[model samples]
Target: MTVDLIAVVPRNSRGRGVQRYYDAQSECAFFVSEPSGQPELWHRYLDGARDVYRRFGVEQALEYDAVADGASTSLFFAALNADGDMVAGTRIQGPYTDARQAHALVEWAGRAGADDLRRMIADRIPYGVIEAKGAWVARDAAHRAELGAAISRTVLHGARLLGARYGLATVASFTVPRHEACGAMPAERIPAVPYPDERYRTVPLWWDTRGYSAFAEESQRFSTQAEQDALGLTAVRPLDARCGAGRAAESRRGHGR
Candidate 1:
């Protein structure tokens, strides 16, 4: 997860404002944003993640329905190459006012006797709670980097930037261990909700950032270097104020919540 902060820019070639990070360990580039101010880029990134989800046969995993209102309080995290092509990406949503955005979990809560999850979030993580969603990595790009760990770090880092204290994710049974290693707990009472036409089941997990020691020990992952040629070299460019304005047409078109 170690990367160097080589440059900080307001926008990339696609005109989307982002915080870029580079990792020399795998010679990979990382990009992240919290509800990107650039609407078009946000949509495009979401689309890319969605495309990958469909490939995995779980299009419903994409939370497009909730964010359709367009007031996306979501963060998009991506991994790319030096060329800047999106090799992998995912979305993180929330700090929700309530559990409404967690559609599936909320629907299944009562039946699973996990209605307390809402109370737990309210009591322990009332603010800055982020939901990890639509995680995907390109098959071809897997060899170059640890997409799961990389993106999980991206989500955690993005959450920290957004002032969130906790993270939640509902993922397939098989994907649970990877997240646990990054510091998350399997949320109790989250029933096996069938998705992608009942062939799949998803479970929910929650993580208290304070409880996770990985991020602390892995601090090197976010470190930057002055030299660009170093091995495991990486870079992080924070989003600039200028990039927040977005495109004039997009602003004019407006968006809903």
Candidate 2:
């Protein structure tokens, strides 16, 4: 079938089945909404991001996009079958404002014996954690493998392109939530982070190939065709969203214990 990835705006997301699919999975979850069990997921992701930065000597930092602002995000696209259905999906948490460290990263790659690797990440590091957010295709044994490969490659290329465009880096660490059949896929040259458990092993389409900090204010979503065009790859976007109103009435928002 024809697989296409499109942006699902907030107002229009009402009937997109995103909420319904989430609800179904949330039935036995820790929270009535998304999984808040481990506030550490974000930490782990950032840690992983920074870990990649050390080699590049980039000033690594983390940005948390908690609210859905209709901006760019990681979402999957799977073609519908005979039955007018399109429930397969995937999502990764990042592109966390880190793209300005490529010059050094590219150099680092060259020093490491992979000039192509430097070039691959000179733009973006298709490296970030990914987990299958939703997928109706998992039920079918026949279509599962193809779908998995499609998704993994999709994720990889998205990260690569984004990294290249923004001068950022990323890692595709899939410490995903549950999905047994998905884990069966072979790990390509890219390394994999062990999944949490059966219930949490969400499918990881792929990881970012490269930095930890500095981002381009002009990041975009993972274009479905872009990934395919890259032959497999992975960026960050501007993240200056703010809601400043009557701040005097409140106080401040910064990092502190």
Best by TM-score: 1
Angstrom error at residue 228, model 1 = 19
Sliding window of 10 residues with minimal summed lDDT for model 1: 248-257
RMSD to native for every prediction?
A: 12.5, 18.5
Relative to the true structure, candidate 1 reaches a TM of 0.70
Full-model lDDT for every candidate: 0.56, 0.28
- Which runs of model 1 end up more than 4 angstroms from their true locations? 1-17, 34-41, 63-70, 104-110, 214-257
- Which model scores highest in lDDT? 1
**How many steric clashes between backbone atoms does each model show?**
12, 43
CA shift at 248, candidate 1, in angstroms? Answer: 51
